[model samples]
Target: MNYDRILAARTSRIKASAIRELLKLAANPDLISLGGGLPSPESFPLDLVMELTEKVINKYGSAALQYDTTEGFTPLRKALVEYINAKGIDAGLENIYITSGSQGFLDAIGKLLITPGDYVAVEGPTYLAALQAFNAYEVHYAQMQVDKEGVIPESMEEIIQSYPVKFVYTVPTFQNPSGKTIGVQRREKIAEIILKHDVLLIEDDPYSALRYKGEELPTIKSMAPDNVIYASTFSKIFAPGLRIGFFVAPEKLGRWLVLIKQGVDLNTCTFTQALATEYLTGGYVSKQVQKNINLYRPKLETMLKELEDNFPKDFKWCEPDGGMFLWVEGPEGMDMEKVYKRAIEKGVGFVPGTFFFPNPGDGIETMRLNFTNIAEEQIKQAIKILASVVEEEMKITSIN
Candidate 1:
């Protein structure tokens, strides 16, 4: 029964994600969860999906269900070319490859790039799944600085100067965990640095279209096309269960990823790709995106209002212009682990922010709250309960 000796050494680097672990608790119907960054079911275009499904089966037939080429379905790639161009990223079908999801591409990148002890420069509080994906490759990390504007170019440039990191991985637009977007001006500087250093930049943009507020910023890929690999997904916009996503890399790297994917899942789901093609070319993405924005915006506004009225004066948080989640920093010396226990006991739940960082000890006084899925009334109640727990934790910490 003992398997430790039989397991690969790389397995040691992997650990359970805190957000994923928190998801198990959030499944309890009795609890009000501000945990998972889930899209609202209200926003799902179910009628459209059913319509698309029929068209795909009738038109594509067995091709929709069969194992597709590693390069992905041609129609889907063609549609994405137009989609990315619309997003201001000029890329051809040759530059794109589909995967199971953005997470699949992350794993492929790790496989293609990382070696034992190789460094990947990442934001201090980057996407947990990326950290988890890279961990499997036994890669070490050089933490980059993240201010209110998200990953700082100056900090990333500084890291590149000293650390021999293989590449810079980022979630620049409506970044996960922090939900902070790097400004347009900063993105240009970041692109400049990447070109000068000639290092690979993985620009993840799953939440870019989820903008509920603020003006859109140019993608880092648009600025430095040849140097950056852009990762995006349909999970946020459409449905996560569909498991459709892609990455656009330079021609050479793009080829490499296709070969890499050949060994992974062969290709992303062709049926799903067919659906996504219809979703894009059929002009459903924009309409559905607007629906998502309308559905989520009020929850965000309500949560912010509740926090302002209920949270302690010194407890800090950011009002993100868009995205499913926001960051909250509690009073100094408060351990969010204990606070999570209290929150759950009060029939509420949230992700303790410590797991977002490369180091466990950092972000101890912080937590990430998701406003996308919860109802307005439940969000109000959840925030009230969470705020009380935070207040009580700080009081206990202060007293001791």
Candidate 2:
């Protein structure tokens, strides 16, 4: 019963995510949760999924249901190669390694490259799951500052110069939590710094295809191909449940990643991979992306307008061109955790920003709001309720 004594010490490094735990409360009808970065069920290409499933059954038969290589289904890998190459990255099936999801690729990188106390650099308010994945390996994280254009290149260079980092992790395009896209100049600057220092970079880019505005900026992977390990997923554009993700690394690292992957899950689901291959190759992917943009853009605009109209003048938030979240910062002395509790009591829930920071206390005055999961009407209502909660919380904090 007392398993703690027998458990590995590495387990101590892991902590349950506050947002994930809060998300469990979402099933309560009273909760209008924005805590989880989940896509709208409405956005999933359900009709296309049914069609693809039938196609897979017709084409692959029982092989679609069978065990597969750790490197993923070859057809999926080949499709991803063509996809990436089209994106202007010189990748091929040989350079691509598929995992259960992009999250798996994160874990694999953590497993392969991170030793206990290894230094990893991340954006100040980065993806909580990534921090969690790397933490299990007992890696020490250093935070780089971020601005309107995502991670500040000067801060990144400073961190790399000051520390012997194993790799610099970035969600450069439409980054999670922040929703700030790294601009072209910043991307170029980052590429130059990484090459000059010969540091490895892990570019987690699950949101690039979701762009609804602005010109597409080149991926950091394309800029410094040799030093970058690029990971992407169909989860954002297609369906999350399929859990299909791929990575492009140099041949040496790609081989090792596949080997590590084999020990973990043997391979991703064969049927799912086959389905995704069809989805991508069948010309459905682009139409689905456009559909997502059509549905989400107006909702995001609604939230932004509501925030502008309702929130206190001092409260700051980003205007992301695309992505699922908007990062908001309350007044300097305000406690976002307390505010989150108040918001939940008012039937609105959002992720407190502190959870995104590797150093917990640093982002206490911030929170992340997701606009994609809810409808336009619900978004307006939720923001109104949230504004009321913020007003009440600020009044209380002011009195205190």
Candidate 3:
């Protein structure tokens, strides 16, 4: 059919997500996956959700089922305003917008802001889906440094000065895959840098509500609301299947986002928005968050302890304050893709670090392991198997 000839050139920039691809392989019943950043099934308030679903359908009926505004269900927006405000961010309904999921916000931002070949400064090991989104817009990338504390503000500032960066994107709090948070002081400094450069910032924060330790820090949005376009979702706190997400932006940008969303999906699901409004207003989110912490924290600790007990002396990973993942760095030149293959042969699955890099061929020595989805026993088994794979690779490297 010569479909290539008819397709848009923009399509070339998009590729199947590495995690989604791995998830397909993880479908095997025997496979224990430390790959997807999935919430523990135990964390979902299933009974409560069933109740909410019935209530929404019964109370709202056709309104819950019918089409609504692109700006989202008003009750949900107002609830979000009160929610983030409790954490020190000042948001009004005018500042809010909703979408299919946080992933939608990424694509919409890419659509609204990215010009083909323009630069988007990102963490060296950033969220893969975000890179995928901006990539579809044919955006170039300036990779910045990251350590245990997430993005290094100095490195970000250097990239902004050196490149023609149109915007800066970060997953600051309990970041995906890496599971690191930018501390309050660094966040303040980073916000200052963004303001200085007059570049827009995208704070993709879906994990902050699942805190396992330490006091909660102020959001970058709170520090620099004018410059930061905040994106978060109900997927972690509630359920992923329903797929509702929220954003906070300046009025002009917020209006444009709503308008842009109108052309895309008209609005996020009314049923889910109604459910979310009830969930938030009913104070289910707070109680569910504590339940999630109780469920996930022990699994996180198990993985950390197993890594400490079984991994090679040179292999490194840090304990994140809270989140689903632990970023592991093997010796330089270690091909984690090879390790991933070996681990999978033993019925363990995880994401090789290369998939997250801004630059091709970077992150050969790393991998990201997710603990929340896997049971504690399975996490222990996966860690032991993965460690053995790393050791085997090290031995092979030594022989060569």
Candidate 4:
């Protein structure tokens, strides 16, 4: 039972994510959690999945249940090739590699490319899990600035040019925590910078299909195919439980990814891949995505309206066109760590923003609120409680 002594040096180098630690508190039924960026279970197409499962059994039978290639089930790869090409990216089955989820793809990339002390550029408040994945490999990270339009181009250029970055990591569409999309022009600029400087780019795009308002922007991969590694997931569109995701890498890089995957899981679930192949080829995915958008748009609108009405005027927050979360920043000098503790005691919860940053203490005044998981009334009440906590915290800080 002496686990501490047995743990490896790599394990000792990493700490548990602060947001994940907070999520454990959300288990209490009394808690109104705006914490985790979780999709609503109501949005999942359970009936369609049941139908798809039956179809998979009827069509593939024993083949669906058998082991698959590390490169993924062939039909699924073919379907994804067509899907990405339809989105205007020139892709083929050869460029695609399927994994358990987009998170798995991240891990594979870390395993293939990262060496200890290799510099990685990321949006200042990036996805915490990506940082965790890279950190496990002992990679160093440099933060890029993000504005309303997402990662700032000039900041990205500065970092890319200055650091010998292994790859520039980005969540171009509806970025996690911030909920901001990188504009089309900025996307082009990013591509140009990466191509000109010969730095690799990793585009993590899971929320592109969930857009409720903005015009679709071309992925960075489309702009500079040779330099960008594109990643997407079925979790946001179809179902997270399926654990299916795919990545598009240049031929050489993709070969390495496939080998890394073989060592990791041998392959993703054979049955699930067969089911997803049917779902995509049968035209169910588009409809499901639209259904998700329709369900979440009103919830997002309600949360934004409530925040405007309830929170103090000085508090700034992002009004994301689409995505599961909104980033809220309290007035200068107000620490979100303290605010989060107070809000939890009052029966509401949110992820404090510092957890998303590669460097802690940088986003101390902020928090990320998820609108997709809770009902409208719960959102209203949670925001009201959060507003009260903000006021109380501001008062306490002012007195000090």
CA lDDT of every candidate? 0.89, 0.90, 0.89, 0.90
Worst 10 residues of 1 by lDDT: 15-24
**How well is each residue in 1-400 modelled by candidate 2, as lDDT tens digits?**
8978897889888756666676665556867777778888998877878988999999999999999888889988888888999888998778998888899999999999998999999998999889989999999998999878888999999999898899999999889989989888889999999999999999999998989898877888999999999999999989999999999999999999988988889999899999999999998888999999998899899999999999888899999999999999988788888888777777888888988898868999999999888888888899889888888888988833
Which candidate's lDDT is highest? 4
Tell me how far the alpha carbon of residue 179 in candidate 3 is from the true structure, in angstroms, after superposition: 1.2
Clash pairs for candidate 4 = none
Clashing pairs in 2: none
Give candidate 1's error at residue 214 in angstroms: 1.9
Give candidate 3's total backbone clashes.
0
Tens digits of lDDT, candidate 4, 158-275: 9987888999999988899799889889999999999889989999999989888978888999999999999999999898999999999898999999999999899999999998
lDDT per residue for candidate 1 within 1-400, as digits (tens), equals: 8977788888888745565665566567888888877888878888999999999999899999998898989999998998888889889989988889999999999999998899999998999889999999999899999899988888999999998989999999878898888998899999999999999999999998888877888999999999999999999889999999998889999888888889888888899999998888889888888999999999999999999999888888888888899899877788988899888889998899898999879998889999998899999999888888887887778833
What candidate 2 gets wrong by more than 4 Å, as runs, is 17-27
Candidate 2 accuracy as lDDT: 0.90
Query: Residue 127 of candidate 4: its Cα lDDT?
Result: 89
Clash pairs detected, candidate 1: none
Q: Which ten residues in a row have the lowest lDDT in candidate 3?
A: 15-24
TM-score of 3: 0.97
Superposed Cα deviation of residue 159, candidate 2 (Å) = 1.0
